[model samples]
Target: MIAVANLAWRSVLNRKNTALLTILTVAVSVVLLLGVERVRVQAKESFANTISGTDLIMGARSGNINLLLYSVFHIGNATNNVDWKTVKDIVGQPAVKWYIPISLGDSHRGFRVTGTTTTFFEQYRYGRKQLLSFQQGREFDALSDVVIGAEVARQLNYKLGDSIIIAHGLSDQSFTRHDDSPFEISGILNPTGTPIDRGVFVSLAAIDAIHEGWETGTKRATGAAFAKDYTNHEPTAVTAVFIGLKSRLQTFSLQRQINEYRFEPLSAIIPGLVLRELWSMMSVAEKTLLVVSGFVVFAGLLGMLSSLLTSLNERRREMAILRAVGARPHHIFLLLVSEAGLLTFCGIIVGILMLAVLLLFGVPILHAQYGLVVDVWHITEYELSMLAIVQAAGILIGCLPALSAYRQSLSDGMTIRV
Candidate 1:
């Protein structure tokens, strides 16, 4: 078997240039197939890691997915806000460890504004209990002070002490700008590859103060000079409350309590459960992408098969030369099959190496644009299975050329075809 394999290798090397092109075609396909698979796995991982350590997300009664989308991902708007009294009542639960009351419905240059206390920095966790760290400066010291996420600061070119205006709503062209209540950047958060990287954080009191004197869909912002004291009238409502349980065992009990609260209709969800549900809803689209990639790989392999089949015609004399050396018909078949297997094997190797290189260069861009963190150091079982299937398909396709060469070597046997 080993000697037969060597003969196969030598024959392929004889047509090195053409073989190289075939290998490259297969390599590109492998890259696309594995690339899609990696993204699917990592996207789920990135989403799941965004809000770890929080036991329950309490918000106004609505679609569970909706509350999650607005409060954590900042992808949508909340239909209703939770009263501050309700937030306090939930926090007062004996099972509560700490809570961050978040108020929304505001924006700065298209990025959502998150209003919470300094405790937010300490309590909010992501990517495996990772704490939020400041890239520069410190937490906001006053209501006029704001903390920007890494993306917001970079994209908006904001730095410490840079003044920023808040809009009354989420739209970039909201028309109601809080020009009178400008905020100075106090801090910038380090990149977390989560929603935190895309938000602007401010003191909840500032949220109230900035919107001071506004009522009936009107904004009456107070001057920046006295706006720092706007906390005297704290916000009477918040969009959501992030809750951490005293212990993991009490999470379900507290969740049930929040869901059954009498003051106002409320919904409490486990971030992990919501995340699973979210992915389940999106599984069809994900599978569709996978199927598309599978066809890409098939097309690539078919290209290789065509090259192999075409080369057999040219190599018929070589096949007869092997026959002259006491090489049986099976040896001729193995030779052709081995060449096909070798081409695919090399292609898979090159494709994986290319993906690794891409990941090294793409980490920063992916984090900035998609909040996706891909691991280049590891390959999961699913990836291994995928590679195995591709390799097997390559060997199976090789049989097409193998039988052709076998019949040609027996019949032609050094005789030239006219």
Candidate 2:
């Protein structure tokens, strides 16, 4: 057995280029497989952390998931805004714990401008009810002051005291720009990997004030252009409101109450349900990526198997000599199998390292583009399962060439086959 194993090692070394090429191919495929798994899992983690603590989300009558996307994640626009009266009534309900009224319909560049209050800093929580903290500066005090999310501040390169003008609508190409009533950057929030990290927040009164001037076609004080006296104007409505229930058990009850109320039609959605629905929509694409990664691994393993078989033919003489030295065919088989297993193990290791390196550089870019925060360093059970699959596949497919080599060794006996 020892002699046969030694011979197997030498035979593989003699054809190092073919073995190394097969290893590299399998390694690269494994790397891709691992990378896809990491991304899928981390994307889910990032999404799950996007909104937390809010027991229910109440908005104007519309798609439940749509409201969650636009209001919670800043993904799209709200078609309608619920009347401020509806928001006030909901907040006044006995079952309600706290509420953060969000008004959306404006943008600075592509980033969303969210009309909110200083209560947002205290009531809003995420990633397991973690309160938002500032990285620099202070919260907005004046109506014309704005607090920027981390991504907004970083991407726009805005700093404390930097003035910015808001557009009339929720678009990057808005024709009506509030160039006169520019707001100063008062605060910058720390990165939370949530929509807050990609949005600009101001008081609800500020949104109303800016649009009021647009409605009259003249500033309030000067009755000419930009004016600051519109703060006294009444707000018509808000896009949506995030309601935090006093108790977890009150969620469904409060949601039902809001939906059945005689007030204007509104939609009350459980954030968890909307999140699940959103994930269900993404499941198909995620599964497709996993399937593609599986195919890549299969192709790589087939290549490795073929390479091992081809090299076995060249090592027939070497195996014959070992058989002449009293090595059993089973020993020869075991030796070949071990070498193949070793190659697979090495391939998997290289693949993991490759995935780590790629994600280290890719996380920030992905966050900046899609506001999806991916934790690169964390490994989930799903990824470990993928590695286990790769290892098992390598061992299983690797035995085919070993079986062929054992057959050749038995037949060749004492004679060397060229």
Candidate 3:
């Protein structure tokens, strides 16, 4: 076997350019397969970490995923707003350590505007208990002050004290703009590689203040909170509430109480479970990428096989010479298979290195674009398994030309085949 490997190595060196190109082809396939899998993994991690350190998320009775989507991530609108009275009642409970009331239904340049208290910046966490920190200035102390997310601030070219008008709805093109009460940019939040980077936050009173005259989602009458001199501005309702329990064990009990409340329909969900549910919804897209990458790997192996087979006729003279020098048919076969397997192993190594380098450079860009955070040097079990499967498939492909060479060497002993 050692002699066969040595011969195989020398033969591959003879056609070094072809061998290197074949290896490069396989390496590209490996990079694609691993890259797709890595992105899928990072996406799940980023999504799951979208909200953390909250024991339970309470929202108006709706799908658990829906509540999670609209409340924590600001992806969708609430079907029904949770009454401020109900939220206050929940917060007053002894089981609740602290709570942040979040009011939604406004926008600034297509980014969802959230209404919450200063406690939100202190208590809300993401990506491993990471608290919200300001990149510039400080939290919104005034009712009409808006704290822009990193993405919002960067994309909108907003600086501290820049007054911007809030749109009446989520669209940037909304005609019903809140021109009556423009909000000054108070602070910009540091990026957390989560949905928080895209949010625009303000005091809950500001939400009510802007829509003060507008009753029931229409233009009506009352003193706008932003325009007033800090009087009795009551927020009638909030979209959802983020709850931190006094005791982690009471999470289920509090969640049950919130879910079974008689005053209004409400749902309390564990953030982790809701995240799992969200990932389940996205599994199809991940699987689709995996399947496509798998096909690319298969095609890459076929390209390797074609390279070996195409060189077969050319190597008949080499095979005949080996046979003349007392090499057996099986020896000839082993040489070809060994050469192919070595090239494949090298390609896999090259691919992994390429992926690591690509990730090292690309992770920040991905976070900047989609808020997806990934570990550059981490390898998961799925990635290892994928490499194993590809290596096994390559070995099988390597056997194809090996068997053909074996047959050719056996029949042409002591003679050259044209």
Candidate 3: tens digits of C-alpha lDDT, residues 1-418? 8888888889888999999999998999999999988888777777788888999998988998888888887888898998888888888999999998898888887889898888999999987787989989999987878899898888878899999988888765545678768789889988888888889998887887777667666644434446576555558898889999889999999999999999999999999988998898888887899899999999999999999999999889889889889998999889989988888888999999999999889988987677677777778898999999988888889998999989998878556756
Per-residue CA lDDT of model 2 for 1-418, tens digit only, reads: 5664566567567778887887798889987887777667767866776788888888877888888888888877777888887788788988887888888878898888898878899988877678989989988888888999998988888899999988767555435677656898999998877778888988888887676646655333434232456545546788888888778898888888888878688888988778978898988998999999999999998988888888777778878887787778888788888777767877887777776788789877775555556666676787788778888888888789889988888788555647
Clashes of each: 0, 0, 2
Task: Kindly report which residue pairs in candidate 1 clash with one another.
Answer: none
Ranking by TM-score: 3, 1, 2
**Candidate 1 off by > 4 Å:** 172-175, 221-233, 368-371
| lDDT over C-alpha atoms for residue 6 of model 2 | 67
Write down the lDDT of every candidate, Cα atoms only.
0.87, 0.80, 0.86
- Native-to-model Cα distance after best TM-score fit, residue 46 in candidate 2, in Å: 1.3
Root-mean-square deviation of every model: 2.1, 3.4, 2.1
Better of 1 and 2 by TM-score: 1
As a TM-score, model 1 comes out at 0.93
Worst 10 residues of 1 by lDDT: 220-229
**After best superposition, candidate 3 residue 147: deviation in angstroms?**
1.2
The better-scoring model by TM-score among 2 and 3 is: 3
Quote the lDDT for 183 in model 1.
90
